[model samples]
Target: MSFILGFAGSNSSTSINYKLVRYTATLIKDPQVRLMDMAHCPFPMYSEDYEKENGFSNSLIEFKNDLQISKGIIISVNEHNGNPSAYFKNLIDWLSRLDRNFIKDKKVLLMATSGGKRGAIGSLEVAEKMLSRFGADITGTFSLPNFFDNFDIDKGILDDELAVEHANALKEFLAKITV
Candidate 1:
């Protein structure tokens, strides 16, 4: 069956961004959602020597295959010092090496959440810029500020206003990625 791939730009075992991805996946219907964790499918540091000596690992190849089959992607990025975390950035570096245009022509629904008020917006902006270089189109975005205050593990987005906004963003993303 056709599916959309959802993942968080985080390798942390307790990443809030991953929680957001899981919640978002539940909101999507029709095209099934496949959730992946960066922590689970690990990648070594990207380097010319590594690429030449090892080529693409089986795990990387499998990830690329999944991306190719995906109707779209949902990524909830995590911020570190106002940018994407080192682990996620490294993964992208290796992914680009595997196929410079692996994400090309894919529609993306970008989201981020953090403990702080900015809600990892800096990383979201950086990711948007970088993904554009790979030819991925960001069709919609949402950032949840003060994640703990506004979100509940079981109930999802807590505030009515934010819930409506999230729903709207999902609607926009669905319009672009699905027939």
Candidate 2:
């Protein structure tokens, strides 16, 4: 029984990215999924001073524990200026201090969503590259552009074709990783 962690980068209480991540996680079969929220991590801005003073917070320790034991990860990052949100990036920085290869050799499903043409654009690419440098084995990548129009709360993915496409992509990604 493989365990997977699912989370979005944003801390917004009603984050669409979080909702999408949760929905996507349900598409995977035979995996125990643990959904997480960035807000609960409660990490301050990434600074050497803060890190030295505070060390890894309890929530960060808990988050890392979950990752260390999981078989794979499902992450959906929210973009801020064509990059990872400050909150998520900060968390990653802190995790790296604990272990340089924090995500090394771990299977990863990387995704991002936004209301722009690029749909979190270069952020996903950048993250994949950086994480891979630390040995992250990214199995698949998904980007949802113009999220506001493409997805909705009541109906989920509004476009049938797009929905099928994303579902197939996510399923394929999970299949490659699980057993």
Q: Which candidate is the best by TM-score?
A: 1
Model 1 segments more than 4 A misplaced: none
- Residues 38-84 of candidate 1 have per-residue lDDT tens digits of 77877888899988998989988899889878999999999999999
lDDT of 1 at 111: 93
Candidate 1 colliding pairs, count: 0
lDDT top scorer: 1
TM-score of 1: 0.97
lDDT of each: 0.91, 0.82
lDDT (Cα) of model 1: 0.91
The Cα error of candidate 1 at residue 151, in Å, is: 0.9
Candidate 2, 41-108: lDDT as tens digits: 57788888888887877787778888878888988888888888888778788889878877878888
- Judged by whole-model lDDT over C-alpha atoms, candidate 2 comes out at 0.82
